[model samples]
Target: MRKTLLTAVRDARSGLALRLIAILSIAILPLGLISSYQTSKVLEKNGALSEIALLDRTRQAAAEERALIQSAFGAVEAISAAASIFDSADIDCDAVLSRLITMEPKYIFAGFVDTRGIMTCASNKERANLSETPFFQDQFANPGGLVSVRPMDATTGGIALNVSVPVVVNDDLIGRFWISIPLTLANDLLGESSDTANLLIFDSEGEILATENFGDDRRTILPQDRSLQEIVRGQQRTFRTHNRRGDLRDFAVVSIVDDTVYVLGSWEPRNTGALTGPSERISLYFPVLMWIVGMAVAYIGTNRLVIRHIKRLRQWMRLYSVGQIDFSQARLQSAPEELEAVADAFRAMAQRLSEQERRREEDIEEKTTLLREVHHRVKNNLQLISSIMNILIRNTDSEEAKHLLRRVQDRVMALSAIHRYVYMSPKLSMVRADQLLEDIIRQLVVVGSADEPENKVSMSTRFDPVELSPDQSVPLMLLATEAAINAVKYCAAANGGKPWITLTLQDLGEDHVKLSVENSRSGLAEEQDSDTDHTGTGLGSRLIESFVSQLDGTLEINALPDRFELHVSFVLVKDEGDDAL
Candidate 1:
């Protein structure tokens, strides 16, 4: 089994399939890989640059917002130092703070905490302790200085940015002044956008101040964003990263202004028109797709053009080896050039073989024709010899010599008829047995009627048309003819001269035939059947026995005082040889 497999693999046609597959794989693989790599690089390069471009624009926007917040916080000092308002007697703190709130809508609250952390000039009578807030404590630690504590909880709205400053009277601490601004204003400042650009502001302490994607149906801030933490810890001014939903990637520019970290970035959603459309995506992976398609095409083409054709060619050559030359079977339609050329050559070679075969057949036919002509001429020659023998028989004085010459004449005439039948036959070496028997019987019946005119012998034939090869026909015919002649000649001597001969020839099945000649003789028994036996030692009788034995047949001879019967049964041949038809 292993040897058979190895042989199959080593076969030329099998190797051709392998060679073609290898060649195509080698040619297409690198091309696909290189093309895919270059295309993806180009796509990614342009995409990152475009995101960075949008990020830069967004960074500028973030900077403007950050400056606004910082300026608002910076102005808190001037607002707190409004001596016209704060230092005035019977100060209406609520009206003044409410007026400031009306002036800057972003300021959610305004108040002053004294050295005891109590609201002295309060915006609201009920107020939270400022000393607990980081910026309020941080301000008193550095008096008259402002502190921003962001990512702060708002009192009534959203997340807030808190800024506080310590107020002093001649180096004596008075209170801490502070204001709160909500980040919702910052979100309102930068409206929803088409790009993946979003805003993020975290404080210096690595706390997430705010996150805003700010688009239709997009989250403003993702809870527990680890990527944001990585950005804050890392030292990259502008870092590139993909979003949590891997498909969308961003290039972010982190800017620090007034102690706030502002991150501006744009993401490219990998799934959503990242490279315009499907054609662009295909271009990015063009090499990979091409490689796959190339492999498929190579396999199918090799099977069709190389392997299949080679197999068919091998099959045809095998048929040709056994003399089955069918040129049309060798045709390979719509094949590759090299294979087609081979098929063309195969067709040409098969054509030559067909022509050669045709010529050989013609030569054989010509030889058969010449052989038939030879038989015709030999028949004519034998008939001439029989005519001469007839003259010798008529001129003879002795009865014994006359009888021998007549028997010899009978033999010569039977041989002449044999040759004549062979000449008339379509094939040189085959003759129809029934026709030869009928012809020979007619001639001998004429002779039997001539010698005894008063007892004219009647002839009846029963036979099938059996095809006999050249060697079988002559011997079988002579044996039958000799039996008929002896019966015809002796019937008068034994049965009062009124002769009636019945010739029986039949297909006996199993490639065999039976020939029988029964004749009435002149005297002796009143009735006799075919099984009745008598012996004769004449030359014709001996010749009949010789011929029958030569034909490998069974001969049954029964000679009664008044009748004689002869029967021979034999097999026929049907192959192309001396014994065949």
Candidate 2:
């Protein structure tokens, strides 16, 4: 089975389908992989860059927070130092506190303490316990020095950053000056944004000082080693982070003093992981869709414009290969430039093939029909000539007359030989003149001598490959027959015969034909020469002239003692309407 299959494939032309499949594979696979990879890379880069941009904006917000906190701390330090020079003799605490309240620093509370750490005056009097303040206690322990602390606020219940400086009299530590600044300014600095998450401020001990939520106290400070925290601790610069929700968040923390750490955190959501869902879906299916569309179009285009026309052309070619050749009209409509040119070539080929076959068939048929008619007419003419000679022979009493009748019979019989050859041949518009003449001469020798044949006479033909149509061939053949008979019968080598006949055909360089018949024979009788130009010339001579003129050809007659020669020149005019026929 395997061997049979292999043989069938070899006979059939196996590689066409495999080659198309390979072409499709080669064309499609690399593009598919490359397109998928490129699409993936594009999506990846877009998502990553968006995330980076979002983180950058959040970091900017965080940096703004650090700036706001630092500015608020500077205000608190200015107020605390200003309180140090306040009255000690008049002790007009109310007047001094009212003057300090006019400073108008945002979200700051200022107050003062007496020599014994007793609260004297307060700007936020409802919330102040100056003697118990963390800033006041720290400054009293380190006398004549400044102190700052992030402490729980008594009024708003949020943390406040407190700054303190010693009140000195004559360079002696007398009392303390203290001020409080709320941490809610961190959230205020980062303005309203929907995609921005809650901002929180945390103290150095990781206690929530301020937040976007009012009543919430949950501390959300990042670990100390987090990117945001490290950046704030190391350089007081901005940094960004990703939370558990995959939100890009940023924060800035700055230490206003040894005890005060200000923090600002801002978050914006990053969904790079979510973008893959749509991108992967498109990547998985886009190439398959392209291939399906491409092949479908290829098949349809190839079928309508290429395959069907080629099949028709192939069928026409097969018919042309055989001998039928009857195509009168063969045309195809192949569009698209290349296919149209191919169709034009096929049409031309079909026309040529049909013309060739038609000419071939016509040649065969014309030869067959013309040869049969010529042979039939020649046989009838010979029979009539023979019959007429027989009648003349009976009427005449002279030996010469009887001899002429006998010679006429020999010539008639020779003409009959040519007819027999034409009848036997498959197509015989013309005969090979040399072959016909040789056979006729041999027959003449056999009949002329009953006991012995003339063996010393030689017959040689110098004819070119001349094909004579029936009109030219018939009379010329008969003339050669008659001449050869006269040569053998009347030539002058009495006992030892050395006669010779040479027949030649030349092309004449134009559309003319020349037929030469030569024989080494002595002069013809005087009667034959007179008959050549007159109406009483023998039927053979007259018939030769008549046939030659009928074929639109000219004839020449030459006579000699050593040679009886005739050279015939004629144009081989083709029949009119032959091409159409």
Candidate 3:
């Protein structure tokens, strides 16, 4: 029971059951968070709807203010239409203003100002000269256009908008009609907000025309926000609030009334009554926290259960990339069923590779054995041929015929020497080139000088060790032996009588070789052989040329005053029998 418990714990540490637990926790997180998530989304949507409704309210108020301005302009146009209003000399200006103010109670002042900056006809009983006021002085330069001015009130110490229209009759400019109203007229339109939100109105001239019911201590604000500026430029249609600079939760829009721009908005405080206490905020965010924790655990558990083992298996295979493969020594431990199957496949593959290598080694040994037997058979047959030639040479009585027979015997023995070396060496593919040459010259020197030791020719050789294929070495050895035999035969007539022959085998780098044979020769030797039926070289010359061609070599023959030299050079490619071809 204790072993079972330990195994269970190990499995749970990095196995499917732990992964399943992580997955279950992940699945439960969304269920826990759905209510809080929906509540947040609903609150966001309601906030947007409230902002839109507040914008609509400001738009309606602006439309009403536009209508009020048009009414005020119509009142001035109505009085300007009468011919008697321009005849200011006989007019009762105060009586006229009283009648006009009674007609539309919104307009408190109605009078005419002359070019001299004095009121010519009065609308009020307490009318002054009015030349000091900048509001009426601006009318003389622009005779018939409407203008607005903000003049401070004596009693309230606040400013009001004074609108004036130019008064002209029958191409005669008498003065201008003027009307003044307090900023309280704007507050009549914007009543009150439903919540803690406040309303404000401003013109592009940096004047806060009207604001919420700010008591004596209420702080009024001007909407100079970037969003409000964008609205004034007509680039942005509407805007929301941001507290990046200050706590300004004022969602506002812009309205253009008679070339005057107005910003109308509502203000919301930073920490509202909706989301107040710490516990309430925690309840809103707890689900999201649980979701993050659950997903993290699930990812770690799944990586341990499946991904980690896969990575370990990849590491095992990567070892083979560096030419190392040993399945037994690097055996994979127990794993999930699928991974165990992969490990089993790797072991089976390793077994097959070992078997293939063993069979390949056996094949190489068998081929080598067959090759050695071939060379041994060739050597014996050539030796039998050489013995028959020797027997034939002894039976012949003619000296010329015996000389020719000995030459044939020398060629046969050169062939036998190459096969002898191949069969003797452990490797059957190639024979040692230096030993093959030495053996060829050894047999030639012994047989050629055996009967004539009195005129014995000295033989000297230089050799460089190189390996040649059995086929190529046979041709090469024959070519060298033929040149050596010719030198031994020509030595008797050489002028110095110190008759000598030399063979030099040299290696030129990049797998090339040079073979040279030189013997002392004289004009007397040609005269001695001139009476003979065959000149010194008839058949041997042809045989030497054939071997040179077979080896893809170049041969040069030079017969100087007292010497004969034959030089042959050929390329030698190791481990390949097809170098020439």
Candidate 4:
């Protein structure tokens, strides 16, 4: 993955699309920055307004809760002012309290507690003493109107709000007139707007009084770092924090009753009603969308306007380099002006090169035809000379003169054969040496056999394909002719065998070749001495040496008891035009 990423980055640096994207991005950078700044400011302003709105909603919910509590307080105060309920024992306090409870369904229990913390009058028959309860003791010590949350009331046997007012007869506190209001009443009041917010009511002592729209997993949504008391300290204020579930929420704290009760409203920050859904999305994504659109346009435009044409030109150049000069100008006609000019230049160069190549081929053909004709004439002239020598040999009577004439005739025929092979070859500059040597050796064998027809000398020849220039082919042909003539002249059968001559041409690797001519020796001692005496003239040896020198070759001669062998090895020099062909 790392290597692939590095390679991608390197390619991107050199790619036209990426460069265009970078250029477009830089051109729009200031506009993007400005858009981002404006978005931040808009969001910040909306956020401030959202906080204020939350605080206001919290205050409204708190007011509703306070009104419910004050109503309970007012009922208790009104009942305490009824002197007949506290002062006149005959007024049937239980009946009046029970009647008050019946008239107000919010109150579950309404009664009066005397100074000794005894339930002297009661709405229900079941009664108990509250003197030992902390709320009763605090109320008795303070002796004023008070409101508190009761988790469980002894009279009602359920969660309720205890609203109390001191019962005074003639400025002497007789007992406390208290009413038990069900906590459900506060919940019902706050639940009306619970869909928009989660509400929780807390007393001065931080005791929860009621909750609205809270689920059983309330702990997850509630503040984790602070208690209700700490939060309520910031009265009429709003703040942000992450709930126990790690969700960021906005919270507002507002007083329901002065130093007595408070209500907290919490909701997710994303739920802020400052902007519509589409508006918010547009604000957040506008800059990024703009950048993407700009980059896309740049990439497409560059690929079409420049890259595609350049690629076409590059392909054409590649084909032209390999001699595929044929082209269509239709594609180039649509390219930009500068690229079209380049295409025109390349087309002109290819045409000129093609014309030059055609002319060169024509000149080579003309020269080769002329050269072949010259070789043909030379071969015919040499053959004519050999024919004339034959006529002289037939007409002369001197045996020595005929012998010399035949020798000269043999050399002339060898030269004629070399010219014949050169002109017959496909290439004027190179001749197949193996074929020329084969022809020359056959002619020499025929000539040598004719001198002594009774002997009927046996001959064997082997030739491997070898090519050479005329300069080397001529000397090589002459050398092989001389060797074959000597071999046939002195050949003798051994052990009752017929005289035989072997001619072999081999291609040694690395541009070198070897030619060998070997002939058997006679078993008779006198014939061997006679052969040694004839070789003393040194004419054939001298001719072989001179030919070898011309061919830039090495000569090897083996004169054994049974056979005589001559071998010539030389490098095959190739013509310069061979490579061009």
Q: How would you encode candidate 4's per-residue C-alpha lDDT over 1-581 as one tens digit per residue?
A: 99999998998798888887888899999999999888878877886787678878777766777787878888888888884545565678888889989988888988777888788888885567888877678678756677766544668787677888888887898888788888777777878755767778776667667776434675565676777777766543677777777877778877766667777787766556352346666776789999998888888888787888877888888887887866645366367898888877877877888788889889888878887899899999999999999999999999889878988888989999989888898877788877888778888888888987887888998899888898888888888877777777788887788889998989989998998988898645344333333244467777788898998888777777778778888888877775475
Put down candidate 2 lDDT per residue, 1-581, tens digits, no spaces.
Answer: 99999998885454344345457767898998888778767766765665456545545545655565555546545655555455565555556555565655554666667666566666655534546766455657765334343454553355654555666556776666565555555445544432355555555444454555534433333433454344444643444555434555554343434435554545443344222345456665687778777767666666677667767777877876775455557666646677667767776767787777779879868776875787788888888888888799889899788877777787687777778767665545455655676677677655445312653556566666555555556676676666555545544442345766666767776667787766565454444444442244666567666756665666676666555666777776543333244
Clashes of each: 6, 2, 3, 0
List of clashing residue pairs for candidate 3 = 93-122, 94-122, 94-123
List clashing residue pairs in candidate 1: 494-522, 494-523, 495-521, 495-522, 495-523, 496-522
List candidate 2 segments past 4 Å from native.
1-296, 299-301, 304-306, 309-317, 320-397, 428-434, 444-456, 462-466, 493-497, 505-512, 521-547, 554-564, 573-581
Tens-place lDDT per residue, model 3, 132-247, is: 66665555655454535456342113555555666666777766766665557755554533344455555554445555443442233433345334446664434444534355
**lDDT value, residue 262 of candidate 4:** 72
Q: Estimate each model's TM-score.
A: 0.44, 0.37, 0.43, 0.50
Q: How should the candidates be ordered by lDDT, best one leading? A: 4, 1, 3, 2
- The reply for model 4, stretches above 4 Å from the true place, is 1-303, 306-331, 523-537, 577-581
The 10 consecutive residues of candidate 1 with the worst lDDT sum are 526-535
Which candidate has the top score in lDDT?
A: 4
The lDDT per prediction is 0.67, 0.59, 0.66, 0.78
Q: Relative to the unseen true structure, what is the C-alpha lDDT of residue 518 in candidate 2, on a scale of 0 to 100?
A: 63
lDDT for model 2: 0.59
- Pairs with backbone N, CA or C atoms under 3 Å apart (clashes), candidate 4: none
